[model samples]
Target: MKRILTTFALCSAMIAGSASLPLHAADAVSNTSAEKVLPLNQRMAKKSPEWLSRGIMYQINPRAYTPEGTLKAAEAKLKDLADLGMTIVYLCPVFVADDDMNREFWSPRQKKSQMDSPLNPYRMKDFYHVDPEYGTDADLKSYVDTAHKLGLRVMLDMVYLHCGPTAVLIDKNPNFVKRNKDGKIITGPWKYPLLNFESPELREYLFQNMEQWVRDYGVDGFRMDVADGVPLDFWEAARVRLEKLNPEIGLLAEGTRKENQLKAFDLSYGWPFSGPVRKVFVGGASAKSIRDSKEGFRKARPIGGDRIIHFIDNHDISNDDYENRTEERYGEKGVNAALAMMFTLDGTPMLYCGQEICDKNRHSIFGSKFGCTINWANAGSEEAKRRQELLRSLIETRNSRPELTFGELIWLDNSAESDVVTYLRKLDGKQTLVLVNCRAKPVSVDVTLPDGVKRHFDLKDYEFVIE
Candidate 1:
């Protein structure tokens, strides 16, 4: 029997007026009348910074971003990213990684890198120092400074749940790490020692490290890795202290916990929607699956202010293998359709380093031993230039139109729900219609809006239109 997941209506009633309500009153309204409930769009705008809503995020794996694989080299590309319409540049971990070449155990992915001395970026040896492989403290400061000058916000990937066995924290205070009944340190999925959040000393040390990034490096925000592994209270406390330094500091949780947004984070990963999205294009899933997954997420996380970060590719996905890349699995045209849905949907969208040019090379983070550096040479190719233009235009459209950013997403019923997805983004009396063909063939869809106006679309393979 095919299990049916509870899904939201495809043609739900349009969200009505609640525009003037203050963001601070979200809690009070929830306790009051249903009619006074704040809409999702307004709540998001109220909770997050205006620039965040209008901006697109670009994830840069420093190891693969440039041939040099150093902070100095990556700094040179800030203007190019800004020119490409990216307002946020999220860098993967650059902290001093464990270089214990004699370590017996290695994860499968690490083994794939085939490095004699693997330096997985996630395995941190010291929280305060930059990995010599990437650059020095001064280089990091310059990178952040350069990004700010180019009108881009830099967010550092923080691996807080676990650290390399020889981390300074463990050496300073062995009790800072969690241990089993036998008094052996507990190892996480990546074979790194897990930090004991219960230790107040450990908590204080990690909190201070975060403050250093903001104060010394002038980082605009942090993307917390394996955030769910840590206690929510810890994140809440960290946010309080960090906000005292920079009120506009953003927190993006790598976990799907909805409550992360209530206070600790500005956005959570849209893991549920990502799978169905990929299936629609590559696995021949119904277009309705996309709608179903999104509605499922909304139902599970009913908070109006909650937001998600949507992406088709990121460091983890790309490093897994070349065949897993969106461009590799579905080709450029299919990637275009996926990108359209990602950017147009009611959430913040993210792009991996080479996604704008549709680069299909795998970017391994363990090391460059497997020849995993991004192929910048591909950027000069004609096909890459065309895809770049498409991405740039999509970002420009999203940034210029406020409705697309915080708009109420109202799914419209269409004749070809199996292959076509239709919706409207309505905000402040303005509405933008979006039609997407999820399949790689011609789709004829007849969509009817809430106002009873019907429109016909002859969408070519994986094509999308926004008007």
Candidate 2:
């Protein structure tokens, strides 16, 4: 006779207290055991590091950060970022890139580079070494060391899903590469050869490389690229190993999977919220869309301790379409309002390298070939000075106010929902009210507080206030 397993039998076997109970009784006992396992949100909140909750992330595209485009040159500006209240410095991929530019399948962005042999940082040739164009391994070490001294954490952008055709792994471990049924290597979104995560040897190799960064460079964390493409189990296993090295190390996933927040990642991108924000401010959509999106995100991910990394602009958006830049499309006041929402909202805020100066130029990952370097000369201008002061104030406020970082968010309905957004954040008996005008015209709104106190606000074009 074949053996059979039933739900009641399994429950009875697993729970000692349910072993002697009836079938229905055992089912109830199993349900009780299930309740003991905390919800995903509470589990995430309990396990996430304190530093991650209060961090202000700043992205640095080394190739476009300075005229020299070297890590050593970029190191000189660390103090400036620290002064601006930035807690984390995220560096884009600096590893050696494949030099075979003659490949026909190069992406459109890659072909725009002016150099005869354009070195796209995303195409990794060697994970172990830093690209000489950006300086040596010693330079990277010094950069991390200096950041640590300034009380700033460092996160490297990890591209583990795919690699250049001529990557070192191809010659050393060919079986590590993913292939189709026809025996040809599989390509990913960037037209690069994908890695086979099913191979334990390959997984171990990548894990070792991750450890090398922590062991040798003392990196605080990693911002995973195309994280959704990789298996969730791999990230879960990687997090377990990484935690043994540094308990505080953070893992930021670029994708938006809710499960990523359960175990594999500390934070994920806030695309759901950002898209509606762009629609409202840039596409002339109703401001109410912003509120709807936020509520939708909350409903979709009911277990809410998951954190999102919010940004007005990042490398991919800025590079893909120069015209879509926040500053270029929305102008100075619009940029300020958008940033205010990002800083005062529920998620952790991030700033791209040149965003503070109202940089109108695109800072491409491919350096000046496809885009321009930050005009440091603009720092001395009156306009740049004003932007810097405003950003500094915002950052300081966010860092000092625990209420803004760990508060409960409540959206307040207002008369001007079409052109304005109003919300409240409460924590530990402290309440903060945030009002933002999303349109280019003045807006007046009547907002009634939970205490039944009514107040009126008149805001100028694209203005934001935190009370």
Candidate 3:
């Protein structure tokens, strides 16, 4: 929920100015520079094919996915997902929860209409077994197989920072938990108990159990939750073991920090970009500030490293929106523009489960969370269909264009009155200029291009090439 990066060092000059604040770059060069060229072979060697390089990830909330809310039913929609052009599918949690049993176990309100059974699936009841409500272990395998059949890789949400006090593992293996100064084991967050990664037995058990998920289910990787809470040593060890199992497997960290970027993870959340991007779109934050912050992160990356995962909405954002935001803030057009920003820029972009259909309802699942279902009836609506179609086109374009997939990025400077952000990505001998107008008024500005060849990419119709 919180950001992990605190360092404020200027690392690169490729960051352009936006509305947030004017970022000055003394040595900034034009988009057509020799250093701005990336080779496809080199990028493949450095980034690997399994890291969702140029791929799109779609987030699925199992509980809220359907009225039935079972793995079987969820799996039935794999075709619908793949049809949307999502290559990577990420499900929140599959393991049974300690709290999902009673019909009203999770909902505090107790109102039948507002209440769904209690199930914080992420709070593990048993790492080795799947929750019956969600489905059986074999069902999980089926889901994985089905996803692979559709050409989609699955990333399970790993919540290892802590577990429910009543977790079966707690009673079966007391050593799996963190201990206080008294040498007594603690359990649950309410009890301030956490997994003691320092203990040899605990460490071995956690690592093996996690590795088992990959081995048994044929899962691609883990989207580690609260990754910052865990130490680097644990991650380094897990990375080593997991890599041994499948080197091409992907690892996504929820926490994004410079210290965690030491090759242990394939990609991490792009908070540095997400935070500023949200502010700029809502008019609370300036595009200039967002660009400067992103520049700071890019400056820190080594020559060849894992790309960052960029997005405007996720479980975190949706949950937070329940508290202080509204669907109006991210209306249909606004959300689409945000998607365009994520897709055109560097790194893999994530689409939250119901984003395509425009689920405006903001409710948390922590309590009697609405368990808001995707409006399937609206699936055929013009707005929903259009968004999905646009997403498909962008994804297809990204997959086809080597330059967009692994190209070097150079942000172009527009005038102070400009509300549009322009940048270029280049690889091989090909190059593309992406200009996104974030304003209501029509923008008329001269954009410099490589070899003085300016091409305009219209976000409205998904068009490119300068006039």
lDDT agreement with native, every candidate? 0.76, 0.74, 0.63
* Number of the candidate with higher lDDT, 1 or 2: 1
Tens digit of per-residue lDDT, candidate 1, span 1-467? 11111110111111221122211223422323443265443333226665665668999998888889999999988899989889999999999988776465356667755665657888888989999998899999999999999999989999999988778888899999999999999998877889999999999999999999999889999999999999999998998899999988888888866566656777777675677777777777777777776666555343554467778778887877654566778777777777777777777889889887778776778766555778788888887887787777778777777777877778888888888778877788877777777776776888888878888878777777778
Which is better, 2 or 3, measured by lDDT?
A: 2
Better of 1 and 3 by TM-score: 1
lDDT of 1: 0.76
Q: Write the per-residue lDDT of candidate 3 for residues 1-467, one digit (tens) a residue.
A: 11111111111112243211111111122223343364321222123344476578988777667767789999999998888888899888778776635442232332233444445665677777888878899999999999999999998998888776567777877777877789776654333247777777777878998789889889998888879888878987898898888878788888755545444666777777677666665663444565576666654443334356777767667655663432457556556656666776767888887777766655444432454555567677887777777677667667776666666776766542135556676666676666655544344545555455544333332122211
Poorest 10 consecutive residues by lDDT, candidate 2 = 9-18
Error of 3 at 429 (Å): 2.0
- Range of the 10 consecutive residues with the lowest summed lDDT in candidate 3: 2-11
Error of 1 at 272 (Å): 2.5
- Alpha carbon deviation, residue 372, candidate 2 (Å): 1.2
lDDT of 2 by residue, 13-40 (tens): 0000100111011111111445438553
